[model samples]
Target: MPTEYVKRVLAACVITVLSISNTANGLAGDTKEYRIGLTSVIFADGTAFVNDWRTYLTHHLQAPVKFVQRQTYREVTDLLLAGDLDAAWLCGYLYLQHRDELELLNVPLFKGKPLYHSYLIVPSSDTKTRKLTDLKKKVFAYSDPDSHSGYRYPQLSLISAGIEPKHFFAKTFFTWSHRDVVNAVADGVAQGGAVDSYVWETLAEKDPQLSRRTRVVSKSPEYGFPPLVTQRGLAQRRADNLREALMHMSSDDMGSKVLQILNLDGFTVGNDDLYNNIADSIRIVEQGG
Candidate 1:
């Protein structure tokens, strides 16, 4: 064979092998089961919620899907970063902190908006506490320390008011979950608590008795809601598949039903810039101002 022709033939063979390898990898991704991590959220039971999410993803992706529940957002993030979880639903605070290490998958839309707030809640019967300042020198409950709406934003709100949570509150503790924060405030275990507004509203809609026991004393400005994220080096084909299934979850009957149960409008593509404000808040809090 001519030297030029031989070189062309070898290049073509190399391209063909690469193409075949890519296709095989895609096929493997399509058949591979995934384990997803979920942070604690309100539900009748964690097991039931996990099963529901598993059913939704398994049906939508047309593959086996398993969900692992973590008691705290930090645990979920740790599992995801350590490669124990294929993906996770993590709070925006943690997402921003580790944004460079992960890829944004989807952000859940609630009531047509992709943002939510942190609410400072006090017992309905407590007339003395009207705002965050009113809770001064009183026991305060915070959700996970890594939670945006639970801890970061609320701390910023208190800082903005010229009071540091640690100094202003008689004592502080973390409830680990927004629902637990609500329960603590309702049961008067804490004089006031900070919680995700979305979780509080969902509880209000589904379990009014628990919600009605508390009143919102203040609300932080809207912040990006928590998002589903995967490791940065995840297989592109697998990430694309999961993103597609989640973004279109509300367009079909089963998906729509699941959305209803989860109190979500649907999922949509997210941008890292959406959480920049959370980062700004973090900076302010960490600087003690």
Candidate 2:
């Protein structure tokens, strides 16, 4: 069963939190909440799943923590860049795009793997489209324009097949979240969609009825999972505290429970080199090779 605490923060609250000034510090010696930016990539409906994270971090950092939710990865990245957030969990694509201005905090370890894939999914009843090429001239969904799995890697697959996404699909739309992409394909709103494979699999376990309606037609090569990052100039002491909290999350009872809810083993320090594959993929897609 999903944790009961997951129902605490409704989507409206998340949006309201994002609209405020969430700076981590306000005047010296004054207690302030550490604002963490989260995009819809992982939590599309609400912020309940990460309620425990807030509790754990508050206890460890000895400061209040507020989760600032955004509708897209780009928005979260922008918040972090503008110093409105102390840290953010963002897609690997956006991390690489702004690596020069950000500092990697940690990368999640899922089932012992630091790598993840992008799934090209189609409706289960669609026998005509067994592979990506078969979906040519068909309506498709992409999670976000800046998403590596949703856009870049999928576009690379098309380039590999001697096709360009713009000229290949009958229609293409951004759903802004992997779950939305899955639903779009399952409901026949889109013939196919590209999504984070981890999100697809998680939904398969949590909502089989919705997930079962779609099938993965292809899987992109594994790349670094999305990472938690902070602005480069964030206070070293605070950054270390946040990193320590995440890395040791599996050691304590509350933290362990949060890790389990997130379907992650724990967090580990990650290097920028881990995302070179995404960088190379972006280059190929941009050069239209």
Task: For each candidate in the order shown, give its overall lDDT on alpha carbons.
Answer: 0.84, 0.85
Q: For residues 85-171, what per-residue lDDT tens digits would candidate 1 score against the true structure? A: 888888988888897899899899988988888999998889777778887789989999888887887688878877866788899
Name the 10 consecutive residues with the lowest summed lDDT in model 2: 21-30
What TM-score, over all chains together, does every model reach?
0.87, 0.87
Which TM-score value belongs to model 2? 0.87
Off by over 4 Å in 2: 1-31, 43-45
User: Model 1 residue 45 lDDT?
Assistant: 38
Q: Residue-wise lDDT of candidate 2 within 97-118, one digit each (tens)?
A: 8989999999988778777899
Q: Superposing all C-alpha atoms, what RMSD in Å does each candidate have to the true structure?
A: 10.2, 8.2
Residue-level lDDT for 129 in candidate 2 = 75
Inter-residue clash pairs, candidate 1: none
Q: Report how far off residue 82 is in candidate 1 (Å).
A: 0.8
